[model samples]
Target: MKTDTVKQAESAQINVITEESKQVIYKSLLSALTIIAISILVNLSIRVDYVLLGSSLGETSVTETLQLIMLAVASWSFFLLSKQKPHFAHAAILISGFFAVLMIREMDYWMDMIHHGSWVFPALAVTALACAKAYQGGKGTVNEMATILQSPYMKLLIGSVILLVVFSRLYGMGSFWQHVMNEHYVRDVKNISEEGIELLCYSLIALSAVRTHRELKR
Candidate 1:
């Protein structure tokens, strides 16, 4: 009778733990949605879509700068997540490194470095090292990482990010619309769409890292 009671107690504890995990995940997902929404709203307001607001979309402007900032945030968040959660360390490293590269590229340093003829081997070497590190630790595989990150909220976030890449600000370009719609004149709303989408995407990445970190703390 004592043995049966102990087993029942253990099973109940396991269930409680599982439910708590689920709640954490759900909260993280809500955070993701909030981040995306807030980013979009802020970007839209600043760009003023189609209205002349003297945005940086005219040159290699505010959009790139914003992207760089968000990438930095994402990278930092991933680094924190990696330290806090060993099981996700590999994925965190991979993502953090990628965002770092993206942030650098967005700043146009790659072009200047190449122009000076000094950007060849180092970039490739760094990339290779990062890839090796990501695949090194046996705590988790890429597939397992994907599985852990494949909740509905994450799926929505991923879908939006993919759309931002595939469709891009190209959809908002006047020439693109003119070419497709057979119109003579169309107005491109500066960099509103591009920057807005980028803000949303990077915010999602950052929020996901924050969520993981919080969950691990528990």
Candidate 2:
């Protein structure tokens, strides 16, 4: 009778632990979804603003918006996933977010606003330090990392970033639209470029999702 009672207690404890784990996973997933959604929204807003007003409003506006979104996403993802999947989700968010912040600084440089452009590098540095702690004995899943790295969409996204970096550097300190415009024709090439880049980023993210779904099916 005592053995049976002990078995029942063990089973109950297992059930309770399982339930708690599920709740934690569910919350983490929800938070990740929210952060991703907000990042998408911020990217959309930058695209829309560029479409309406061009870069004449200054790339700083778009840079600031993007930075805000990255900050929120990184903070939330780090908090929720660091304990669960430290190497995969936590490290990915931290690295990606810090990279996004660096991109913002690049934008500031492109706009010739060096004085007001001090935070991004420091933020990235701090994230780097935190990463050493967060990923200390954690190793990411090989299959998941392979799945992400093998996606064709990721290749295209990487190519696009390379192109944008080159283009932005070559045309420094002035709006692309301003350079393209003449007294007779006011062409807004900057808007078109910004919108195209935004679409490409979204498409890459969607493609990642599709790739994961396909992998699950197989």
TM-score of each: 0.62, 0.41
Per-residue error at 144 for model 2, in Å? Answer: 7.7
What C-alpha lDDT values do all the predictions have? 0.62, 0.50
Candidate 2 clashing pairs, residues 3+ apart or interchain: none
Question: What tens-digit string does per-residue lDDT give for candidate 1 at 1-218?
Answer: 46988999988887675867989999779866786686665566456533555654542455555556666876787677677767777876776776676565565554564575344345556567667878796556585468547544456546655765666655656666667657544344324555666666666655555555455445
Q: What is the lDDT of residue 151 in candidate 1?
A: 44
Estimate the lDDT of model 1: 0.62
Candidate 2 per-residue lDDT, tens place, 1-218, comes to 57988999988887675767989999679757855775676567666566664554344455445543443443443334334444455444543545445444535655354566565666567677656643653555344345445655456545645644564445432455565665543434554455445433433333333333343234
Q: Which ten residues in a row have the lowest lDDT in candidate 2?
A: 208-217
Off by over 4 Å in 1: 1-41, 48-53, 58-62, 109-126, 143-147, 150-153, 169-175, 178-190
Candidate 1: residue 170 lDDT (0-100): 58
